[model samples]
Target: MKLKMYFLLLALGALTLAFQSCDDDDNDGISVPAELQNALAEKHGNAQRIEWETKGTYYVADFYEDNYEKEAWFTKDGVWQMTETDIPGLAALPAVVKSAFESGRYASWHVDDIDKLERKDVETVYVIEVEQGKQEMDLYYSESGIFIKEVADTDGGHNSEGYLPSDLSAAVRTFINENYPDARIVEMDVEKEMTEVDIIHENKAKELLFTPDGTWVSTSWDVRTSDLPGAVTAAVQARYPDYVIDDADYVETKENDYYWVEAERGEEEVHVKVTAEGVIL
Candidate 1:
């Protein structure tokens, strides 16, 4: 009995020491090199809440600036490697990359996150995370937006499940900025067939859809009352002086474009449809 108890104690001590060694190895004990820290300070002004960790041969610094999440990587000798800026939606991607991603392989996969990576070599790549159901992947694209290849996903599960290349993302954003300046996009969801961007104005959500090539697909939000063509708003006011314009939307179908307006008076609501020229239909 005494011999068995001694062996058990010896085994436990060995296991504890092994665990401690493993923990230390995982920590790496890497500190930010002075050169890397100075380079980062010069490049990004002041990094807010930055966290540093070693990955492979690179040291990654994750930080935030102006309410945006960004990552910077540096070498052990303090060489600035690359900076990655997380784009909120595909609409913000560069135009060339956007076009290539839409028509390239894995376009069907839903895009989740887009990181615009800039390296000291003056090379640029777009790291795009895409997923469908259970399967997830990361794809790399060239500076002009050509397909590269798949990379192992390092972002665990932070980016939401969706897919879109940056260029196409930018086009979508441009359309919204040009047409609906007041609405701000909040969430972007990509599907196999279409991409949807949700925007908000005055606490109301509006959904906009686009094709993979950045073609405007459809919208679920009423057009801003102020953005309505003067002719349309004028006609509505002339026809129903007491009613207030509550909703407006410019809709396009294969057949023709339609201007839709909804007006309200007390408890009464009215729907008016017209052509772009303000001709009531």
Candidate 2:
């Protein structure tokens, strides 16, 4: 009986050890859904050392591809949202993208960080984080070197006063001075996908848009509905008779000049672009 009891105690000890070993093999009690695993495999066949975690409504996968760390986010339903890859250095960026940043408006800012964002159905974007003094900003660029947009760092609470005259590039300054010599620049915003300058010329407010390289895109100014061109007024009256002409603007682009008119009837509103000759565009 004594020998039997001893063997029973040893068996119990072995069973407890086995249970502990199995628990250790489980990934912190987190089971990756089979759907998510399948999605990750389909998207990143070369991914290695993958680790998974749940963040908010997204399932995040951290892995390495080509020996570089990468992160991919997927929706709960296994739809790939985006992937971010760390760029080792500026040298790793495409030539056009690198050149654009070197010659762009924020060239003097110190580069803080860089990342490449690849979305499911959108063009890849390169993000460059830069800083000057207390002002930090994120500049986004396309693969072909087109400046996409600028976003100020929210943590710094930087209230942009708009670009000052000194901040304007020579080309931009020359264009404004030659075109609107007597105009005073009221404000300048470098956000969106282009630089916009607000000016007051001859007691009228006008906004000018420019590419990052200082090429002119368009100029626009508000116009009273009654002040709209006869052709524009007639066009709107004929097409949207029940809608009241509430607002209008005269816009001049390199290609052509047109009037943008807004018509509203209750909650239903329509915006129409009509040329000076009354043709709707």
Top model by TM-score, which number? 2
For model 2, residues 183-202, the per-residue Cα lDDT tens digits are: 65544567677998766666
Off by over 4 Å in 1: 1-33, 54-58, 150-281
Per-candidate TM-scores read 0.39, 0.49
Task: Estimate, for each residue in 32-138, the C-alpha lDDT of model 1 and write its tens digit.
Answer: 76787787787788687766787767677788877668878776777676677898877888888788788865789899888876656333667788887877888
- Assess each prediction's global lDDT (C-alpha) against the native: 0.71, 0.79
Q: Supply every candidate's count of residue pairs whose N, Cα or C atoms clash at under 3 angstroms.
A: 15, 0
Clashes of 2: 0
